[model samples]
Target chain A: MDKPIRVLVAKPGLDGHDRGAKVIARAFRDAGMEVIYTGLRQTPEQIVETAIQEDVEVVAMSILSGAHNHLFPIVVNMLRERGADDVLVVGGGVIPDDDIPVLKEAGVAEIFTPGTPTTKAIEFIKQNVKRK
Target chain B: MNLQERLAAGDVRALARLLTYAENDYPEAEEVIKNLYGRTGRAYVIGITGPPGAGKSTLTDKLAKALRARDNTVGIIAVDPTSPFTGGAILGDRIRMQELFTDPGVFIRSMGTRGHLGGLSKATQAAVRLMDIFGKDYIFIETVGVGQSEVDIVKTADSVVMVMVPGLGDDIQAIKAGIMEIGDIFAINKADLDGADRTKIEIEMMLDLNENKAWRPPVCKVVAVENSGMDILLGHIQEHRTFLSESGELVKRRARNIRNELMDLVRDRVMEFITRETGKKLTVDDLVQRIVAKDMDIYSAAQYIMEAINK
Candidate 1:
């Protein structure tokens, strides 16, 4: 059987607003990707552990809190240190435009801001996921 | 090191990678499982199944924690439905069990039932074996929110804990026959709700009509989110485990399950082989398309399939 692209959509840091994450999870499912959604308030360690255990090719986190610059890169680095560098780590939700380049330099494959269509994220994952 | 050595040395990444390959039916995973098959059968498998919104995942999280507090290594496989049209799924069972994410003693995997392949239960059984080989003391297989007739978990777990909640479809769901009989233990989660006792009595009445009375399935009230009644639920599950052990039914039951799973595995493989084309030959799918177009009959298609495989 052909394997579907597996993605882990999580809400990291203290922000509990997960409307964006849930929307992406649903969109991923509709796009024929198996998404493992770990609900709100996850730490970076918890996110990376789940991504590893699930063997997900993509880790897409949505954080509304102002800690994306701090927490998102930590998750990316942890995945790399854990030998999970193959995973495509992406971040979304309330972040300034200037920090996007910094996040990209920190090994985040892409950053989807609020107005970015879910299809763009889906397309990015399709083009970037290592498993495919 | 090889896969077996890595697994033996407690490599989580290797285990996770093997599980992916196993689910996709890769030959490397088959070789590893063949080598480590003897390491299985030591872990106790518990199946948590119920309708959607029954709190099975929450109950599962609490149960694993309870077992972990007693220093037992736990493995959990939480199953969710795959989309029939899109072949995708949202395996969000971990949303409730996220607290166990970092616990080295617990391994939780979320699975989607891609029935287009029809090998879901087979892969699930293999996953259980792999987890057992990984040295878990208790393995919990939580089924997708099931209706009647999705009882494949019976072929995987030694004990099936059927979860129930109050006010779901009223008394109709309680009286449903097929899934109701498979519960070795009945848990009325969200028991703090209004109709809990009524649901309990409904289960008792139905269980009294069970054909095999060797063991009486206990109906326990539980509020999983608050963690109340968990101890009693744990005690009852333990007691049921001991009963199976004492009466020697555990061995007999496992053997029966293995036999059934082996039969399913053969069917899965044969179906896989038949659907794909052999060189330039017409496969079963093409034959079916012909039958649909009235260019070929069903009997001739069947004969062609038989003859092609015989070659």
Candidate 2:
């Protein structure tokens, strides 16, 4: 049997609201994937270390602190440094349209803004994970 | 491949990847688990739970550091809350334990409840198993300090620690009923506060009422911010581990945990299968219309759906 996709959902910086993160975690569980939430106020290094330690195929971060410009790139670079370049870097939470391309360029797989459905995120993961 | 071999070889990357696969309930995760299951039972599982502001994160950091000082490798699993809309976690535990991130002897992973109703995420057990396989002497599981669900999740630990603070008014009473029974060690953090003594007494009162025949859970006071009383807390943890081994309940408790995990996984899988099979043929609107028209009773309708799937 194939393994379910393992995702590390992280909140970076100091945004304390987690209602959306909790909802998405439930959605992924229902979708039959294993989801690990790294609680709030994480640094980029910690997020990458967690992804490496957990062997997560995807590292999805939720940042409402508007610090995505700094945090996302650092996380992407750290994953690369750890030779986890294959691990997908994705994020959500109040990212403006102008910054989406920059985030993608920085190696984030995709950026999810508000109103994105849980099913959409799950589907994106299912489609993109590098199958072992 | 054997888990011990994988771990002894220092394949931290592989160890983590395997844990992730296992936690997700992937079909392949089962084989990985079967291959590595016996390699587990060596690591001590400690569950840290309490109210939100009790500084559970800070205590976890101190404990990890203390355990490392004793020349033991540590694996920390911090369970955070998940975002509902995006299915992501607000991974906050790293803030308190950032110092340990660079330490070779320490590996920290923060996890979210991910909308699991029972307080902890389903992946937590698998993560613990992975940490065990990775050869950590201690694996610490910390939950967001809610109530019943947190207690339910921590029950899987080999030893459970309940953390409390002096200033979270009425929270002591609020946490009394469900958490009081499962705690192997009670920590009243922020002992520098005015009511620290009162909080300690309250915990003692609760502990006295629910004395265990096998082991007596101790109440210790600490100021987590200052790293006070950590040594005593570690001592109590070691004592509890000794109690488990000596009482012959270690294996029994582990077996029971395994049994519960298997049942939970089976239940989850069965529900998924039913949902997928039925979901294709029936919509919520369809059921509502049927009930509205009095064509079928709700229970019978459910039975009909189940029978269809079975057939």
Candidate 3:
């Protein structure tokens, strides 16, 4: 049987508001994906470690603490260092449109703003998540 | 030459990979566990849980260090809260234990609750089993302080330590019910604070009200930041272990835990199978519509769904 896609949803930095992250987690669960949520105030190293330990197909980071530029790339680099560069990296939460391109260039597959529907994110994962 | 043998020999990379395979319910995980299962049951499993800011992480670090000093290898599974919005974990538990990373004798992994209603991750028990097989002398499972669910998950441990701090305001009321009854040891952390004595007394009072069992839980005072009272706490942990073994409840409890784990795994697998078989043909919305339109009652609808799979 084909395995369920495993996704790690991480909240990077000092962001304390986790209601949104919880909602997305449920959405992914309902979509029949296995999700591991690392709770609030995670550093990039912690996120990478969890993603590796969980063997997730995707690492979706939600940062609302305005540290996305610092946190996101650090996570990508760490995952690469850990030989998990094949895992799809995505970001969400209040990212400016102009910054999205820069984040994408740094190895983030896509960035979702607040209003983007859960289905769209799910669909993106379905299409982009590479199976080993 | 199986994965379990490799794990038992202290192969960190293999252990990490095997744990992931197990977490995903991969078929090979069963083979690995089957090979390693008999090698387990040697380690002492300790569960440390409390509310956030109770200094659970700091206490865990201190405890790990103490264990390391005794030349006992330690395995830690820290259950961090998951971001509900993104289905991710902000795994900050490791921040306090960074110094142990290079210590070959200590292996620490942070796991997210992963939307499990229980405070601990669903994969936690399995991970503990893996650690036990890896020949750790002590394994500590820490929860993110959400209350009852945390207590339930920790019930699988051989000993449970509920950490509390002074000035938490409702410390007494919080420990009055549910998980409170399950604690084998209570630590009033931050014992240097003004209300530390009061918190200790409250726990003592609670214990006094309860009838004495063969093993009475002890309350210790500790300042985790300063690493004081750690020796006494370790003595209490050893005392608890001796209590469990002397009472012969350890084997019985482990048997029950194994039974519960087996049932949970079966239920999860069966549910996944049924969902996959039926979900392809019918949406959850379709089932809802059928029930709402009175075409079928909820039970009959469920029966019909089950019948569809059998057919």
Best by DockQ: 1
Tens digits of per-residue lDDT for model 2 on A61-89? 88888999999999999899887899987
Top-TM-score structure, candidate number = 1
Candidate 3 accuracy as lDDT: 0.80
Instruction: For every candidate, give the share of true A-B contacts it also has.
Output: 0.88, 0.34, 0.10
Query: Residue by residue across B95-142, what tens digits does model 2's lDDT show?
Result: 687678668798877666666755578788888877887789999998
The DockQ of each candidate is: 0.89, 0.23, 0.12
- Give interface RMSD, per candidate: 0.6, 5.2, 5.6
Q: What lDDT tens digits, residue by residue, belong to model 1 across residues B1-311? A: 98778887888887888888877778877888899888989999999999888999999999999999999999999888899888889998998998899999998888888773321344788788888888989999988887777777777789999998988765667677678878899999999999899989988988887778889999999999999999999999999999999999999999999899888778877767767644248866677889999999999888887776777
Compared with the true structure, what per-residue lDDT tens digits does model 3 show for residues B1-311?
A: 76666787877656776777765667766687787778888899998988788988889999999999999999999887765655544555766775665577887776766667666887788788888888889999888775544565554688888898887765558555676787899998989989899888888878877887687789999999999999999899999988879989788878888888888889987777777777778755678898999976899778867886687
lDDT tens readout by residue for model 3, A43-99: 676677667655678998998978898889999999898777889999999889989
lDDT score at residue B80, model 1, on the 0-100 scale: 86
Error of 1 at A90 (Å): 0.9
**Model 1: pairs clashing at backbone N, Cα or C within 3 Å:** none
Name the top lDDT candidate: 1
Query: Model 2 misses residue B252 by how many Å?
Result: 2.6
TM-score of each: 0.96, 0.74, 0.72
- Candidate 3: RMSD over Cα atoms? 6.4
